[model samples]
Target: MSFTLAIVGRPNVGKSTLFNRLVGKRLALVDDQPGVTRDLREGEARLGDLRFTVIDTAGLEEATDDSLPGRMRRLTERAVDMADICLFLIDARVGVTPSDEVFADILRKRAAHVILAANKAEGAAADAGVLEAYGLGLGEPIRLSAEHGEGLNDLYAQLAPLADEFEARAARDAPETDVEVGEDGDEGALPAFSDKRPLQVAVVGRPNAGKSTLINRILGEDRLLTGPEAGITRDAISIRTAWDGVPMRIFDTAGMRKRAKVQDKVEKLSVADGLRAVKFAEVVVVLLDAAIPFESQDLRIADLAEREGRAVVVAVNKWDVEEHKQEKLRALREAFERLLPQLRGAPLVTVSAKTGRGLDRLHAAILRAHEVWNRRVPTAALNRWLAGMLEQHPPPAPQGRRIKLRYMTQVKTRPPAFVVMCSHPDKMPDSYVRYLVNGLREDFDMPGTPIRLTLRGQGDKNPWKGRRKSQPSALRKHLKKGT
Candidate 1:
């Protein structure tokens, strides 16, 4: 694990703002309203030359019971305990309040390394407040303006020694590098397991479609809060787990409703958070309620996933209550075919998030989708397929000359992208491109994964490609003399 820094403060003190600045992105939901952040968000933070893990925690409240604020407090406390250091922030504009005093005392007892920071200390208005922060007895406060990217150098100065210590410890603890040898004592290629990276999968859908239920069931525990209530999940909480022995990280996002219906500021943040999860995930499961599958919003969500180029898996939740199983299944197939033509052969697995039925099938489908998303085809095979395709239905030429496709090769994978060297590529019709893409999908067994096909015409060096070469004047005169 890397050095972890947990930012702790009361609500609206710019903890998230500081987090966004450090991470170089607006990952956490930032609002002027207090208590906007209700969960712990973690990001890889980079400040100057220091790189470490930074946690954005929910604001601390005075509550100590099991209420919502209380729960958020516990989560924040967990983050504090898990961190290597705690950044206790006080709002310089608001000055030190009783809540800041309370949290400061708590951090004094809980954290080994506590750094006090007075945020929003950009102008003379906060001078008195910045001086007042000294009464907390945690040492000189680092005056900061997180929104304006001020005071980071001082922050980095505080963190440099810690980062150096962590790097030294990590280097000391790292295992010696060694090469694997075959049974015959010859060096061998590294095993496939060496390439393992945590797979990110996000479960998304409309409100109350069992998104949380499905994720909890897959995890085999009630790690995430869930109930019959719609919109219970407000943050995109990502849980790390192993699915059937394969390491994976699953994100349970807030259910996204239509744009007009999302009026609450908090809900808007939640929706944006969910969209970010989808964009970050490697595979997106658009869980739909079987009773009301393929709603306009459902189609929109699936389309969004597809357009993002993430591998998609359509899952029908609440299958146990579904009546007329065979009829419903057939109808689902037909509806999927009719509605989502772009994701033509994407996996549509039926599962009951409540009863956990069909979970194994869903797991297999997810793994398969991930595999197809990362699939690669060899250059030889690609050119061969291109040849067969051109022979079957050659590109249509608008003028007299026929368009020539000279070379084709896979440019990259992870949603296989190809580039075809050709003549008159600009004139190639969209219909022909679609034809080639469909052929690639069908022949490559890469159903539902996005395919990128780029057509490139002859380069400038080959400017006279389609023109006939005229005989030289000297050759023409010699031929006339011979006649």
Candidate 2:
């Protein structure tokens, strides 16, 4: 039996610290600054013998307008509604503030089960604040030091009974197992996850390119924080959801800027985290602002994806606002070919992340790109193609001798790496290698995906090259002479 717990509180109340403690990871970015987190980050948490889902929400704020803080507050309220339990946190050193009391009133009316916690309670100075928490009318506050790992036992004691109760209610509500639908319009099988493993796709671009907005539209909910803020996302938050029945784990990364411009320490960490996500991802979507498409930083990011051997997809966002679509798209294509020749022939999808338009096409392009990335070629087909290519445009014969490509075979996939057994491998020119790579891409339908082609000599090491006859040969000669 499983249940979800949401950690909620005002800014810098140690909610993220406790979340990390519960999930046993520093998944959420934490800093001394207030309101570092602005999204609903969920993880599987284990406390003692109990295991369940936990959500780390943005700090409760007093904003009610359509500002960033207000949006963050709305997102947190959604988490409280979705979670089975809410761990309301307070700063024991500072006691409860007006914002805390206001949110407490809200959570009392909304949350099904609330557990008040007085965090940062390790020293005696926090005792008065902990005592002052009793006036909030939620319940007795548990003294906790999330950084030092204190008060977890008390937290566990509070959660065990609730866990058992949830398990009981789930058992009661569970449908019967011996039922099946005939051919009529009756009930169907229970919902289950797709049999395929979730495809990992990372969305990366410069700031304010609508990466998080696109993800939220696909999720059909406001799962990520978004506003006019360019860098609302501070961490590479990965959300697993099925898009049109295909399971996927999508990462919403922080907007990347030029290295020289990124001076803030926390932004540096956030960018680093996003870069890590790009490396872990199989397909990377390089989003572009339609108005300012293909800037230097955008090209750098796409080139980074190609160099990392990730399948690349270029998505031009904000198409709804573009005035001359045809002209702009043609210019974008020409620029893409002129600048990013490595990712030539990749699918360039035009989407409006705000209106949720062209998402179906985007989905198809991603799946197709992934398919091309993981494509494998048979040795026979590769050798046949190699023979044709060699015949049409032979290798450059440097000096007097010709470089012979004796054999070719695919060594691996996931970016489709290949090795060619050839004589004078070290003498092959870069231009010739590029020719062969271009031929492979054109002939094998592997356009836009990174292709690794290696040249190797067949005789780098021979067993009998420098060795004399064994002692057994001398022994045989001596025996014959004696005979």
Candidate 3:
């Protein structure tokens, strides 16, 4: 089982900042405004060699039982209940307030284990508050500045013991399970990750589409070589980055071209490398040139992602020089619907990779699309939807015999795949299958991620019955002897 940790604190106490620090990404929005985080965001968190799930919760605030703040508090309480440990953060610069004391009391009552953190403890300003945190009775607080990345080693030391204890308990409970070691070493080794880890995002497009330029701008450095030259990047190179404190691993792929034009051996190699990057990526951002958007190659790349069952987001790059922005966006939407019908509702964000205009929106759109792609529709809701669909348009009869699609169940997620057990699998037409897939995408709000519908034929006989053996030989011999 995955270990869970919750980051809890009052508003502007640097909970989001500490969350970003632990997760190593700015996934949670950080603003000076109080109560900015109204939702609980959970991600895999890593501290040194320790890995666990971490939930970033909304700030504790004053509200009635039915109010929004109260609802947020309930969410935080739920996180506390689910967590193996809680990291209670306080702003050392501001010192403890009545709200802090109230929340501390709540945490004492709710959380199973608590680790106190004195955030923003950079200068002498925070010394008094750090000393005052001892009054909370949560144990010694680890003083650190989340923004400047100070005192992390001390934080790790505090967490390592807890992690080791959890791991030891888990191992003791599962002694019979085989722990196979892989070529890399211990197969059972704890996964190296945390929610603050960078998201693995790949930028793919045809040659000379400014993929390199976009990556450089995002990094705010000349990390990847860029020029007016086409096919400069011959191999996929990944760069580790933090966007607004959101850890992101970006793969800049070589520009892909048609198979026929990729005659050169180096270009062919580059294409293969790019393809591999796309396969490995969790989310693919297809960058298109604003001047020549939605070409045959672009459609093919998008189709490749759908076929491979990867999440996709389209970015129309170099929009700074585009003459008719609105018209182009409209036409692009139509073309996406017409050409790449499978990814009909996938997000399309227009950006000038040159000027860095609309990059934020682009990032936001990619994150949202990824969330939808990874979404799981509950089995109950799915079956209800399926029943409604079958009621509206019953399966077509083949040879005047009605094909019974008996039951449907989701077999897998992450590009949700469903298996529909039916009377005749071979008789199901392609049109009807497409109808179901389309309906699933539209009704369930799953766009961009490929939906797989499979039909399993259930034959007319009960398979569990034992085979019958002939017993007439002995009786026939006995009758002959009597005669």
TM-scores for candidates 1 onward, in order = 0.76, 0.93, 0.58
Q: Residues 237-343, candidate 2, lDDT per residue (tens digit)?
A: 99999899888999999999999999998899899989999999999999999989999999999999999999999999999999989999899899999999999
The candidate scoring highest on lDDT is: 2
Clashes of each: 0, 0, 12
TM-score of 2: 0.93
Cα shift from native, residue 483, model 3 (Å):
28
Looking at model 2, the pairs that clash are: none
Rank the candidate models, highest TM-score first: 2, 1, 3
Candidate 3 per-residue lDDT, tens place, 1-483, comes to: 458888889888887787778888765656666776655666777877888888777787766475656766776777788789999999998998888899899889988789998999999999999999999999999998889989889988888888888888998898586877667776666433334566778999999999988988998965555667687676566667877666778888889999888887656766777888888887899999988889999989988987888889999998999888888889988888888888888888999888999999988887777787677778788788888989999999999999888778888776789988899899899999999999998898887778889999877676656768656798898999999
Tens digit per residue, CA lDDT, model 1, 1-483: 369999999999999999999999877778888887766778889987777889888899899887767767887888899899999999998899998999999999999899999999999999999999999999999999999999999999998988788889899999999987666763565332221467889999999999878988988965565666788788888877888877788898999999999999989989988999998999999999998999999999999998889999999999999879999999999999999988989999999989999999999999899999999999899889999999999899788878889889888887789999998888899999999999989998999988889999876676787899986799889999999
**Which stretches in model 3 have alpha-carbon errors above 4 Å?**
1-197, 461-466, 469-483
Candidate with more favorable, higher lDDT: 1 or 2: 2
Name the regions of candidate 2 deviating beyond 4 angstroms.
Answer: 179-196, 460-463, 469-483
Scored by TM-score, the top model is 2
Error of 2 at 81 (Å): 1.2
Ranking by lDDT: 2, 1, 3
